[model samples]
Target: MSTAHDDLDNEHTILPSWERNAYAWTHSVRDGHIESRRMVTDGAIIDVILDGEPRFVLDLGCGEGWLVRALAARRVRALGVDAVSDLVAQARAAGGDFRLASYEDIIAGRLSLRADTVACNFALLGKDSVERLMPAVASLLEAGGRFVIQTVHPLVAGGDHPYSDGWRQENWTGFGAAFPSPAPWYFRTLASWVALFTRSGWHLCEMREPLHPGTGRPASVIFVLRRR
Candidate 1:
């Protein structure tokens, strides 16, 4: 059982953990070891983004730039941004348009780019960054643009734990032992997610639950939102 202090402390550990595991993450993703992403979330996010027919996209927290490359191949101009230096290097080496920028950098108005679509694929991890980043994302959208987010389904991820908002530890199960420090993620209830979007000057346009092909349970949830 985790106390409030532990949750608070865990929130601050996410980035460092990612920093330590960046290489392992890149390898796992490129090798197609993340089963949920390979079998479901990847296609789900792609379909949602392309559905809007956006010519330009900005992928937030784009690890290894796979989403950017995927969109680029489909004729959509995309730029990938991430905080991890090694991941950015790997992405650039792979011919991806990646910029190394932290979430705080983006929230501080450092990025001067706009796009018809902004996508965050399972990257909104921290509570503070997410609360501040949501409103900032609105400022980076072109006219009539959309923002798409794919994340762990609150209900599905809740499991035996209480369905509330707080930090949860990630052991990196099935991701192999090379991940030395698995990041702790903050979980938000379904209602909490909607409230956050509403307060952030955005409205949910659509919500999708992508089911795992084998288990037939929601593997993740996608939120398609537009600025209010």
Candidate 2:
């Protein structure tokens, strides 16, 4: 039977949509309070990253550079990379070490950067990008380095939707004027996430689902993987 997942699988990339709306998105999340981030995701992701005691961190797809700035405050060398020019500019303006580069550019060896820890905070949005970027991520880390990822939990984020893979539109109902357009993000099942990492030569060291304090439902999932 035809399903939403099947429909999304047939669609092309959604990068252009994000590129077009980078400014609004960046402005929305600049303060870092965005409910979920303030309540759970921020602490969970930062705790995992700090536990590794990495000297250098590459914050891949670091939208407004909040994570990078936080890492720098901890005396770690951190750099943020984002494809969106406006977002990158905002990050730079905020005194963050940020570069305007896409995941595809990094994967294709156009940008050279290696780190003890590479973190992607709520940035791994598409199936195509994840598949193409995983191998390059494996290569971009120091030996025994870790890759920490914080993404929307597939189950909670999917809610009552079909579990099949596909693209889903962002829920911008409460975001107000800051979010002008809803960007469609690709969704993958938990099995798909694990398989992708395993196939890319990474061993999962830890995984945790951060739950919302109010509802006890998962707000996001964190994965700590080490190159093997």
Which candidate comes out best when scored by lDDT?
Answer: 1
What lDDT score goes with residue 39 in model 1?
A: 97
Kindly give the stretch of ten consecutive residues in candidate 1 with the minimal lDDT sum: 1-10
lDDT of 2 by residue, 1-228 (tens): 346565455334456667677777776676553788878988899899999988999999998888899888889899999887888888898897999898879888987868999999989887667788988897778888999999989978886889977778885654434665567777888898999999988899999998999999999999999987
In model 1, the clashing pairs are none
The TM-score between candidate 1 and the true structure equals 0.95
**lDDT tens digits by residue: candidate 1, 1-228:** 457677668767888888898899999999989999999999999999999999899999998999999998999999999998988998999996899998889899999999999999999998867999999998789989999999999978887888888888888888654788868888999999999999999989999999999999999999999998
Look at candidate 2 and give me any clashing residue pairs. none
TM-score of each: 0.95, 0.91
Looking at candidate 2, what is the lDDT of residue 221? Answer: 90
**lDDT scores in order:** 0.91, 0.83
Rate residue 216 of model 2 by lDDT.
95
